[model samples]
Target: MRLILPILFLTILSIKAFSREVASDSLANIARNAMFTDAYIQIEGKLHSKKLKVEVNLGDTPEQTKAGKEYSEKLTGKSHMLLS
Candidate 1:
């Protein structure tokens, strides 16, 4: 009877552990999908009778210019770029 209790306890513990691992894996997958989501930046302007338009898919949301320059540099490896 003592052996049976220990075995059952261990079994239940292992099941809980497995369930937690599965939940962690699912959450990780959701985070990975969100990380890979697509974002964009579009610019349209006129320069002295010339019209210019630019569009780019950045794969992430744009931060404000003050906080975003670093992120843009990290994404493109370029300095002094505007993402918004």
Candidate 2:
């Protein structure tokens, strides 16, 4: 019974892990700019906390640059480089 329970639990975990979908190209691109990348974050440890880092070097795209300019001009009244 003990062995059965452990096997069942492992099977469940494996199934859940396998159920996750692979990221699409756009989603993978977005992940490069997500909070999980290139950000210094404080992580809590059992005894102490430390600043953790995840570096993400993003190659800029024209679409992202245009979006940023639009956002800044429309929302913040700031001039930004126009996306060509």
Q: C-alpha displacement of 33 in model 1, angstroms?
A: 13
Q: Which pairs clash in model 2?
A: 38-54
Candidate 1 — worst ten consecutive residues by lDDT sum? 72-81
Per-residue lDDT of candidate 1, residues 1-84 (tens digit): 879999999999989888833578888888888844354555455433234344555444345443445443444423333444
Q: What is the lDDT of candidate 2?
A: 0.48
lDDT of 2 at 25: 86
* lDDT string, candidate 2, 17-63, tens digits: 88977669878888777764232222222322232222222225666
After superposition on all C-alphas, the RMSD of every candidate to the true structure, in Å, is 11.2, 16.2
Estimate the TM-score of every prediction: 0.24, 0.24
Clashing pairs in model 1, backbone N/Cα/C closer than 3 A: none
lDDT of 1 at 72: 38
* C-alpha RMSD (angstroms) for model 2: 16.2
Considering summed lDDT, which 10 consecutive residues are worst modelled in model 2?
A: 37-46
Candidate 1 off by > 4 Å:
21-84
